[model samples]
Target: MRGRKTDGDDERLPVISIVGLGPMGVRIGHALQAVKTRYTLLGHDVDAARVRAALGAGAVDRGTWSLAEAAAEADLLFLCEPVDAVCATLAQVAPHVRPGTLITDTAPLKAPVLAAAAQWVSEGVAFIGGHPIVRWPTDGDARPDADARTPAVGDGGGSVAAPPAPDAGSAAAVARSPA
Candidate 1:
C-alpha cells in the first residue's frame, strides 16, 4: 500500500486491499486485475508464501505483512481467509479501517459471518458477507449443496480460471449491509 495512488495521483482509481492471500483471496486479486476497472490492489496473509504467490502472479500490486495497516489503506477491503478465521480477522482489522471503507468476504456462510460483523457496523463503515458461489452443473459428480462444497484448488492444471470479468455496475454494488 506504500505506493498506492492517492487523490492527487488518480482520483477515480480506488485502493483495494485483500486481507488473506489464500486461494480465494488470490483468485479474487486476479479477478480484480482482469477487470477493466482501475484500482490499486494490495494483499496480505499469515502465510507469507501466499502473498508472494499473489505478487508473483501479478494479482496484487503490493503485499504487506500487516493486517491493520492494510485495512487502514483500503477503500475496499476483502476478507479472504477461511471461514473459521473470519471472526478473529474481523476483530483485528475493524478498529483500524478508515470510515466509509466497504468490507466484504469470500466466506461461504453469510449468516454467522454477518452476525459477527454486525457488531462492527457503523455510520460510514459497511460489511457485506459475500462469496462467489462456484456452481457445477447438475450431473453425477454434482454437489448441489453449495454450503458443503470446498474450492477446487487445482485440476491438474497449473492455474484456476478467473471468474468472468465483473462490470463496473457489479463491482459498485456495495451499499449498507443489512447486518
Candidate 2:
C-alpha cells in the first residue's frame, strides 16, 4: 500500500499490530520491513522475551504485552498464532478493537477461527482469513539461505487462500456464512 501525503511533506503511515512473535510472525515482520512499507509495526506476545527479541531485531517499532492496547491502536491486526489459539486471542482483543479495524489471521485452518470470529463482527470488527504459503529449506538440505528481500516462493510452492469478504456487521455474523 502507498503512503498518503500529509502537510509539510510528511506522510501518514499505517499502523500494523502483530500479536504473535514466533517463527511465522517474525518472518512476516521481516517481510514487511524488507518491502520498505512505511508502516508502524507493533509487536505483542504473551512471552515478553519474544517481544523483546522482535524489537531488538528491528522487526517492530514498538512492543507491548497488552492485547487491548495493541488492538486499540492498530489499523490492521495480524493474528499469527497456532490455529487452536487464534480464537482465544481474538476474543481477548475483540472488546478493545476499534470499529473498522481489519483483523486477519495466519492460522493454517480457517473453519474453526471463522466460526469463533462471529461475535467480534457484532462488536464492529472486520475479520478475514488469510493463509500465506512459503517454502523453507528442510533440515540437512544444502540450499543457500533464503533472501529476505524477496518473496519466499520456491519449488515447494503453495498458494494463498483468502476467505470470502466479511460482512459489514459483527465478526460473529460473518463466521456463520460459508466462505
Candidate 3:
C-alpha cells in the first residue's frame, strides 16, 4: 500500500495475497501473471509442494508457508481455500492483516463464510464476498489444468466473473482493454 499520492488518490498498486495454492488459487495466479498486473502477488499454502509449484510456474512473485507473513502486508487477500477452510484461514490471518485491508473469497458458498467473517468487518476490514464462476465448460473435471490458458476474471470471453462487491458505490468496475 506504499505509493506516492496523486490528485488525492494513492497511485501505488495493491499487494495481492492468495491464501491457498490449490487449483483455483493457481489459476488465479496464472491469470494475474498473464495480465501483467501492476500488483505484486503473494502466494501461500499449508502444503509446501503447492507453494513450490506455484513459485516454479511463475504464478506468484513470491511464495510463503507462513499465513501471518503473507497476510501481514497484503492490500487484498483472496481466500482461495475450500469452503470448510475459509473461515479457519481467515481467523488465523486476521491478527496479521492491517486495517482497511480488503478480503475476499473464491468459495462457492457465501452464507457461512460471510457469517464467519463478520468479526473481521467489525474490526475495520472490508469483507467482499466473491465467487469467480468459470464459464468454460470443463471436460467433467472441476479443476483447471496447470498450463491452461483461461481468461482472467471479468474478461468478456466469459471465462471468469465475480459477484458484486459489498459496497456497490465504492466498487470499481473492471473492463478489459484491447490487447
Q: Compared with the true structure, what per-residue lDDT tens digits does model 2 show for residues 1-179?
A: 32234347666767789899876676677667777556788889999888887787777778999988888777889998998798898778877888868888889888888887865544456787777676554553421222322334222344354543444433432112122
Per-candidate TM vs. native?
0.69, 0.74, 0.76
lDDT of 3 by residue, 1-179 (tens): 53223345668666889989877787788888888747788899998888888888777888888898888868888899887799888788878888878888888887778777875444567777677755443555444344534644544332222333455434543444444
lDDT of 1 by residue, 1-179 (tens): 23265556544456799888765676667657766366789898888887777788777888999988788888888887777688778888878887878878877666667666766655477676676644333453522122112333221212221211233122333222222
Residue clash pairs of candidate 3: none
How far in Å is the alpha carbon of 103 misplaced in model 3?
A: 0.3
1 against 2, candidate with superior TM-score: 2
* lDDT-better candidate, 1 vs 3: 3
Evaluation by TM-score, superior candidate among 2 and 3: 3
Query: Relative to the true structure, how large is the alpha-carbon lDDT of every model?
Result: 0.66, 0.70, 0.72
Model 3 regions more than 4 Å off: 2-13, 136-145, 152-179
Task: Please report the candidate that would top lDDT against the real structure.
Answer: 3
Task: Supply candidate 1's per-residue lDDT for 146.
Answer: 23
Top TM-score hit = 3
